[model samples]
Target: MKRLIHFAACLACFTVFLLGPTIASAGVSKKAQSDFEKNLLGKDVKALLDMPAYKDGLDLYVDHKVDKRLDERGIDLKDLSKYLKDKGVGVERDEWVTITDAKIDSDRIEIHLGGGGEGHGASKNAAKKGAGYKRAGGSRINFRYGRDLTDADVQADTFLPLLGRVLDTSKIIGVVIPKDVAPQFQEAIRSRDVVVGMSYQMVLISFGEPDQKKVDDSTDDSLHETWYYLKDGHRWVVKFVNGKVGKVQVF
Candidate 1:
C-alpha cells in the first residue's frame, strides 16, 4: 500500500505539471499580468541578476506575459528590434559582441562586454591580456554577471537561450562588459539615498533609472513599486504605507 501511495503521489505531481499550462491559459489572470508588467516597467536589468526569486519571476513573466504579448501583437524579430529602438535603446548592425571578463559577487555576477573601439580601438592589446576575443566594432559591451550564469560561459551557450534570442533578434551588438566595473557600480548603488515616492528622474540622479518598472496596485501595503536595474539585473522594492517610505527590499 505504501509503494502504491508513493506511485500515486508521483503521478499526481506529473499530472499537475502537465496541466499547469492548460489551467493558466484557460483563465489567464489580467490582474496578475498587470501586476507583473507594472513591476518590470523601467526596471534595471542588473537588479534582476542579483535575486533568485526575482530572476525566477522574470523568467515566468517572459514565458507567460512577454511571449504572449508579442504573440498578440504579431511581433517578429524585426518587430522586436523596432520596439527596442523606439524605446531609445541602442541597436547596432552586423557587429560581433563578446564577453570580455566574468566575476562572481555576493548575490550576483559581474561581466564586462566590450569590443575594440574608441580608446581601445580594434587592437589585440586587450586580448593579449587574456580579455577574450577581439572584435572589429571598436566598442565593448559590458555586462554585470549574476549568480545564475551557466557553466559553459560561452556567448553562444545554451543555458540562457532567451538572451541569445534577444541579441539575435535585435540589431544591437551584444557583449559582456569588464568584470572590474561591478565593484564600482555596487558602491554607487549603495551610496545612493534611495527614497520613496521618488520620481524616476530623482532615482536616475542617484542610481540611474531602471531599465524597467513593474507596476501593480495590488502589491502589499509595504511595497509601493518594484524597480529593475538593467545594468546589473538587480531590483529594489520601494515600500510605503501612508505615502512614506516604510522600508526597502533589495533582491
Candidate 2:
C-alpha cells in the first residue's frame, strides 16, 4: 500500500510539472498579444515609430521583457531586435518603401504615399502644351487610377498589395462603368465609348506592362496568349482567345 501511494504521488507531481507551463500559457490573455502580433506578422519595422504597435511592442519586448506572449507564437526576440535596427519590415528599408498613414478599411489598407515625384515634369509639359493631363501632381499619381504596378514598380515596391480581403474594382476605382475599361486601357482601342477590346496595349495604357509575363502552352491553341500581372501583393491573369479578350481575373 505504501509503495503504491508513493508511486501515485510521484506520477501526480510529474504530471503537474509537465502541464504547468501549458496551463499558465493558456490562461494568459492573448487579446492584446494577438492584436499586436497580427499587426507585426509579415511586417517589418525599421523605423519603429512609423507603426505604433510595432514601436510599442518592440520597446516592451526588448526593454521590459514583456514578450512571453509573443514567444509562445514562435517569434524570436533576436528577430525583433534586428527589425528595430533595420528600421523596416520583412527586409531592409532601403529595399522597400515604408508605408505610412495606413488606414485599415474593411477589405484594404489605404497607405498614404510620400516622398519625391515621378513623371510630373512630363505631365506638366503635356498639360502646358494642352495635351490633356488627368492627374498630375506628385509621386502619388501612380495610386490615383488604381492601376497595377509594372516590373520596375515591383522592384521598387511602390505599390504594396493589401492582404486579408479582396478589394472591389468599383470600390477601388470609385467608378461604375462597363468592364470594357480594362480593354480600352490596354489596347487604346475604345469601342463606341461602350466596350473596349481590353488587349495588351489597353492594359499598358492603364496599368502598364506587367513586371512578369507567363504563357501556358498546356492550354489549347484557342486559349493561348494568357498574360499574367504580378505587382505588390496582387496577381492577375488575362486570357485571350484569337487575339481578343476572353476573361480577366485579379487576385
Candidate 3:
C-alpha cells in the first residue's frame, strides 16, 4: 500500500513536470483575462485574436432591445435602435441576434445579425415565411496585429466598430467603447490625432482607414508603409514603421 502511494505521488510530479510549460502558456495574465472577460466576450460582437471558447451555437446577448430593421439590414442592433429613437419611433423588443459561430479562426470573428439556425427550425420557418425573409449576412472582422493594414481591409473592419461607437455616443447599449473609456475614443476621433504609441486597433477607432496605402520596400523592412487619407483637397499622411505610427503629416 505504501509503495503504491509513493508511485502515485511520483506520477503526479511527472505529470506536472511534463505539463508545466503548456500550463504556463495556456494561463492568461490576470489583466488580459479580465480584459477578455469584461471588454470582449459579451460586450463586443467581434474579436481579433483567439478568445476563450464562447460556445459556437450560443446566442449573442444584447443589453438592450433591438429594432426591426436589424432583421432586414443585418446591421448592428444598437444602430437600428438609435435611428428609431432619433426618429421618435418605438424600439422593438421581440428580436435578438444570435451568435451563429463565436469561434472564428485565430485571426477573425464573423458575426451575422441572426444565427444560421442550423439545429433549430430555421429552414422550416424560412420556407413558411416565404422568400421575402432572407438569411442575415455575416460580417467578418480581422485583427491588424500591429501590421501595416490596407485601407480596404481596415475600412471593412471599421463597420462594426463604427456602429458600436454610434451606440456608445448615443449612450444606448454601449458595446464598442466601455462607458468609462467612451470619452477617450470620442475625444480622439474629434481631435484627429493618432497618438504616438497607438495600436492598429486604436487607429481604426480614431480615424478609420485612409483612402490609400503607399508601400516602401526599398528598405530592408517590407512592412514599412504610409497610409493617406484625403480631406479638403489635401492629404493626411500617416507613416508606419514596424506597424506602429511613426510620423503624421498633413499635406
Candidate 4:
C-alpha cells in the first residue's frame, strides 16, 4: 500500500511537470494562438505607430491597461515610451514590415516585427552614430488579454481590431485595402459604431458578439440579421441586410 501511494504521489508530480506550461497559459485558447500563427506569421504588414518603436516590445493590454496608460490620447510623445526610451526607433509609422514571429503567453500575444527585434550583428554592421545611423529594422507588439480568454476572444475578424493597436494588417491574407483602411478600422473599434458597408466579420470585431442575435424573416429571400449590443449603458440595435451593415439604431 505504501508503495502504491508513493507511486501515486510521483505520478501527480509528473503530471504537474508535464502540464505546467499548458496550465499556466490555459486561459489562452490554443485555437486562438494557432489562428494568429497561421494568419500573421510571415505576413507583410504596415506599421501604425505615429511615434518611434524599438526592438523591445510595445505592450498593448486589451483590458484596462489602455485606460491606465492613456496611450490613445497622446499627441506629442517621446520615442519608445513603453520600452527602450534611450534607443532609437527600430520601426517608423506606416512603414511596411514583415511579421517574423508570434507567441501567445499566459497574459499576452507577442507579435514580432522586422525580424523580431534587432540583433547585435545588425546593430554592429551599421555602426554609424547619431539619428542617421540605421539599426536593423525590428520591433514587437505584445497584445495582452488580462483575463481568461477564449477562442472567440482572438479569432481573426474580431482580433484584428485589437491588433490594429500596432500593426495595420490591411493586406490581411493577401487582400490589400487602402492605407487608411486599418486606421479607419481602429477608429470604428474605439467608437464602437457599426458603419454601413461593414461586413459581418467587421461588426464582430468592432462590437464583439452581440448580446442577442435574431434573424429578420420578413422578406424571406435575402438573409437578414438583427443584432443587439449593450454598450455605454445603452442597448443599441444593428440591422444586417444581405450580410452587410444596413442600419444602426440607438435606444
Q: Highest lDDT among the candidates is held by which one? A: 4
Give lDDT tens digits, candidate 1, residues 101-171.
Answer: 33323323233333213232323343343323322322222222332333233232321343432223111
Among all candidates shown, the one with the greatest TM-score: 4
Per-residue C-alpha lDDT of model 3 across residues 148-215, encoded as one tens digit per residue = 22222223244334334212222213325334444655555434446555556666666677788888
Predicted candidate 4 versus true structure: per-residue lDDT over 1-251, tens digit per residue: 99999999999999999999676656756666777688878887777663233555566667644454435522123434523343446777667788889876656677888866665444443343434433566778767666656566667888777776566665663332335456766556444457877777778766679999999886468888999997543578999989988898877
TM-score of model 2 (CA atoms): 0.25
- Of the two candidates 3 and 4, the one with more favorable TM-score, higher being better, is 4
Clashing residue pairs for model 4: none
Query: TM-score of each candidate?
Result: 0.20, 0.25, 0.27, 0.50
Score candidate 2 by lDDT: 0.35
Give each model's whole-structure lDDT.
0.36, 0.35, 0.41, 0.66
Candidate rank order under lDDT: 4, 3, 1, 2
lDDT of 2 at 165: 14
- lDDT minimum window of 10 residues, candidate 2: 162-171
The Cα error of candidate 4 at residue 130, in Å, is: 5.0
RMSD of each candidate relative to the true structure: 19.6, 19.2, 16.4, 10.7
Off by over 4 Å in 4: 1-25, 50-54, 64-67, 73-79, 82-85, 119-133, 173-251
What would the TM-score be for candidate 4 when compared with the true structure? 0.50
